[model samples]
Target: MRRAWWKEAAVYQIYPRSFCDSNGDGIGDLNGILQKLDYLQELGADVLWLNPVYDSPNVDNGYDIRNYRAILSEFGTMEDFDRLLSEVHRRGMRLVMDLVVNHTSDQHPWFISSRSGRNSPYRDYYIWKDPSPGGGPPNNWGGCFGGPAWSYDAGSGQYYLHLFTPEQPDLNWENPAVREEVYDMMDFWFQKGIDGFRMDVISMISKGGYADGPLRPDGLYGDYTGQCANGPRVHEFLKEMNRRVLSRYDCMTVGENSAVTPELACRYAGFDEGELNMVFHFELVDVDGGETRRWEREHSWKLTDIKRVLTRWQTILDGRAWNTLFWGNHDQPRPVSRFGDDSTEENRVRSAKMLALCLYLMQGTPYIYQGEELGMTNTRFTGIAEINDVQTRNAYWERTERLGVSHEDMMRVVNYISREHARTPMQWTDGANAGFTVGKPWIALNPNYPKINAQRQLGDPDSVYHFYRKLLSVRKKSDTLLYGHYQLLLPDSEEVYTYTRTLGGEQILVVCNFTGKEAAYSLPGGWAGAELLLSNYGNPCSGTALRPFEAFALRHSG
Candidate 1:
């Protein structure tokens, strides 16, 4: 109903650790991101959402914040971060920092004081409870990174709650002091001129009092997602956050909401709610995974299923709420690997372009992860030793040892769904380490970099990188693509995903062939003479059948 700057802007998410290395430290830093500002501007991104670069033990790769006001020593000094912010603004781009407030690193000073004794003032800064009568965790809740959610602290003789790894202790959001501190920390950044935050696991900040949950079939611990995710006080806390700090600033806020539905999403991101500008819901990405158990097994998701998931969000949130459009991120496998065919070079480039045309043309703010525009494919990790993500390691142990699954089978699943797949160093050049770093990479680089690096694609007009640039340019100029109404076409077609966007007197028809073979696609009756605005294959189609992975956007020139 109303227009917002964020709604019209495109966001590019940078996993800083893998973006580039400036000091040859084998890790990406603020200076490295500063060096890439021109590259981002050339790509037509108006917003840059960088992953966490705060002081951390890196137990969960910067999600565990040891200090709210400090930058990681490895990532450079605060002055470097200041210069980064300055340069981003100078180039007419906004910077959105990754805000991790649901938990603090166990090594944080507050956690250190809280674990000192039972009566310490900071003790309530975290959730601490006496162990169950049987001398185990306070409840049967399982940590997302594996094992019990409560870790025993021998000194205090109490257990602390951690929804993720034990190194990341859940913060007590119910405590007024804690909430005040969080808001204060947020203000500290807003004062520093950050455009906004991509709040990590923001929905899990509030918990409905600790309790045992339904046990998994393995009988080790219970799934606490229901009890913890989008907990009772989540909205209350978010609303208070807005009233205190966010509303005062003219900025954007997106929450990492895991277990949210469209109805609930409306409340969190509704324009009038003053909670969040948008929220990243995983329904579209989690299409293959089971409802509660993700990455435990592999699944074959159909094109119709993906269409259903996306169309629902588009139609419902069109005017009521907002959505964040993304296919890959630091926590997801590459889109070409997960949703497209990456078996061959041609297919990789074609499908990558197809997927981009499908999502970028939708009605929402689109986020492009680093290297995604280069048509990067998943890494071929040989063994468990090659992975670095804590979640992936935990899942390996759970599926193989705890669930009695075979090692080969578990590795197969990891190969397909591991977050490590997305953490590979950015492939800049087809040189050593994909030109990401002169020293050893902090993580492995996808071997396909030689064939899919940016150096090879930047000059090629038909490359995925250029295609994405064209898409962003088109979106910038076309009101219909940015704010138009979305209507699903051929909703039940398994081979073709089609949609139309209309605004005022303009209408654009989009058709995507979602398969490895040529798909029989026909114009939607009266749209036969529509003017072709975009396409993956060279020029407009000569016939109705689209080539393998072919995609097109047609504007009805009526």
Candidate 2:
């Protein structure tokens, strides 16, 4: 297999807004991240994938880009960003910024000009259409947050498409001018010595003729993913982007493609494909919510279902294209709570390590969200008012007000699936506000911070933080872990997940118990008495009986 810096590196995703507060001003800033660089280095992170810090109105927590070149005042100044980049590079860690060109804030200068008149110079910068005969939206598509995807512009007498919120208008990538602007903005960052980009909602850049998608049972709005994701010219535009700007720098690029399949991923990030280095497909994350609606009632996901999804991606993309391994991110619920047992302290630690061993040992670049190292679980939100996420707030209102669902029931779903769970302030210490800030936090911290804070974990050798450090250290030293061929073992097992990675004469075996109860599994042939590289449980016996949430990696060489 071909080797690259990105292929062997593990990325640490930092949601700056909730990471740490530097000025005691509630919000996390670039200086906050600058302060945490040593913490990340201690955890063995090679790359840092920062969430959007661009100038914005905070409608979608900085996803709505007001100015691609300017840094948000709340985040820090341009000089602060430059210092952060310099410090990151000085520490031998690369930094990747979030690229949110799929949409721009309605207040953006381009959008402001586009909405001024029908024949404005920037009119083609955004997707605008006349009302569909009856004086409503241009299409039946629904915004990702809620309501119609098309928001009316009284000045232009046309409705513009926004897949997310009315404040976030979709960009017209079909225009060569828009594409050039985006590429030039990218070059601006590359010229600043920043390492790479994490493209947000990259698959939705192309639209499929603005056709009406299939309506849901409620008949409010049509499916946006069906009409927009992986559109006709996506690959062509990506190739153009690669040719124009990305090829000039030795950079790492990972696209946030929520609607991609393994085949589509191959085209986007295949070995010979010049588009991106890797892609974040939502198949594993979407298991509980499915493709259409994620805010509804929780869907029961089984171990076999997870196995099927992970095995497919691991095997299919083994030699075709690279994969990105992550359990949770800024937009998803916590991993220990969603995929593992987080009901108890012991369970949280064990399962967090188990999940780490299960996913990180697979063939891919691993991404660790900020608080995930401390085994942060989902937040227990009691009321809608406490939630800070726009999507969660919209879903709560839609379900309780219009759909006639009970408040208690909808809040239950919010507790289970809300993105707010991951957006809670990072738990640095057991002090007030979890050491995230001294002043009021923009959002509430996860209440379990007293027990699960990073300060507490960093001091303990058996903590989840140390486990992750060891796991990454192990990965850094093993060529087999980076480029080995993956094979699923015990594919049908419901309680235990096992896999092996082999490169030439070197082999690494990973075993994980996904449940709270002890599971039984026999070692495969020629695997007895293998050298134990790492294990969550202390000095666990190499016996058939696996403890609850036990995970370990064994090495074999012949």
Candidate 3:
């Protein structure tokens, strides 16, 4: 492996809106994040990726940023950002701010100027296409959030593009002027003594000039790939951005390229020539979504299936671009509830440990979301009125009364798909708003907070938090865990997932029971002499009883 700093690091992602609410504002703020830095260092995270904290209208929460240069007053001031940078560095950690340049809030100064009139010089900063001969949008491209992607303005008599909500107007990366402006913003942040970036919706930067997508079987063509993602000029623009802002700094750059495949993974993170340090894939996260375009369908994700897809990515990208391994993020439901049993305590902890073993031992950087260390589960919202995400509300109305589907039928789907499942405030301790705030939170905390907060888990030796800390320590100290060759063991095991990793003649075997049933498994012939390294499951021998959800990691003599 190359000597890149990112290849050997573990990252933690913080969704600031839910992290902690300082000043009792019910919304997490800069000071709240500052208070958690020590815990982050202790958890063995070297990189911290803070999602958008920029001044925003909050139409889409922090993702729809209105200002690139200023931190939202609600979060904190520029001074707090400076303090955050200093605190991260003081702990020997690197901080990576999210770069959401794919689009800007309609309230942005550039957009305000662009939307002022047809003759405005800033009109070119955004994509504006003339009305069709019939005096309507050029094509039938749909917004990623829903409905048509283009929204017209009476003031300008021209249509602006938005792949998501109308408030978020897509920037015309096709224009050199727009690209330069974005590059300047990158320089400004880097100049602020920040480390690097985690680019949001990165693959969507390039567009196909307002073209339509191919028709689908459902009579609605919802495909957004070739029409927007990885467009023809995207890489050229990134390469130029690198030449101007990124190349000048020895900082890391990761991309939130959800639909990214192995073929293009390396191109985004391939050495000095590539555009990013790594790219995130939602392949694992979407496993339970099944064939539903959204997560409204009942689905069962198999252990074999999950292993198959992830292992293939590891094999394909072994020496290519580094893969980003994550089981949960701000957008997805908590992994323990979604992947393991939420009804029992033993099942949850064991599953969390098993999942940590699987991901941290993989071939790329591991990203642990907030509350993941303590094995937090999902939030239960019984009504649409209780939901916070706009997408959820839109989908509920569209799928229920508008489509005449039963409320019960759709709620089943909402139970699985709503982003609110992950948006609830973090459980810090046993108190009001789960110790996240002294007042009401901007969003509700998962009510299971009393049992899952950090204070309770951090001190317990058998807690999932401790297992993850040990996992991080092992990955840090053992070359095998860091850069070892990986081999799948017991590929055909009905109830267990087992694998081995070896580097510099030090070999470690990892095994786990994937279900709530006790599974019996064995090491290959002549492999019994290995010593136990770090383990949670009670035994290591063949036909050994693996209590439901328990996992094992053993170091064997070569």
* TM-score of candidate 1 versus the correct structure, residues matched by position: 0.97
List the candidate numbers ranked by lDDT, top first. 2, 1, 3
lDDT of 3 by residue, 316-359 (tens): 87766677888888777778888777788887888888888877
**Model 2 residue 401 CA deviation in Å:** 1.4
Q: State residue 342's C-alpha deviation in candidate 3, in Å.
A: 1.1
Error of 1 at 445 (Å): 1.4
By TM-score rank, best first, the candidates go 2, 1, 3
Model 3 CA deviation exceeding 4 Å by range: 212-221, 290-292, 538-542
Clashing pairs in 3: 20-28, 26-442, 296-413, 530-556
Pairs that collide in candidate 1 are none
RMSD of candidates 1 onward, in order: 1.5, 1.4, 1.9
Tens digits of per-residue lDDT for model 1 on 1-558?
688899999999999999989999899888999988988899999999989999999999999999989999999999999999999999999999999988999999999999999989999999998888888877778888778888999998999999899999999998999999999999999999999999999989988759553244434445666788899889999999999999999899999997888888999999888799999998988788733555566677888889989988998998999878999899888999989999999999999999999999999999999989898888887788888899888888777886798888888888888888899999999999988999999988888788888888887888999999999999888889988999998888899999999998889998898999988877777777678888998665668788899898999745
TM-score of every candidate relative to the true structure: 0.97, 0.98, 0.96
Which one is best on lDDT?
A: 2
Report the C-alpha lDDT of model 2 over 213-319, residue by residue, as the tens digit.
33444354457787789999999999999999999999999999968999899999998989999999988987776345576676667788888998899888989
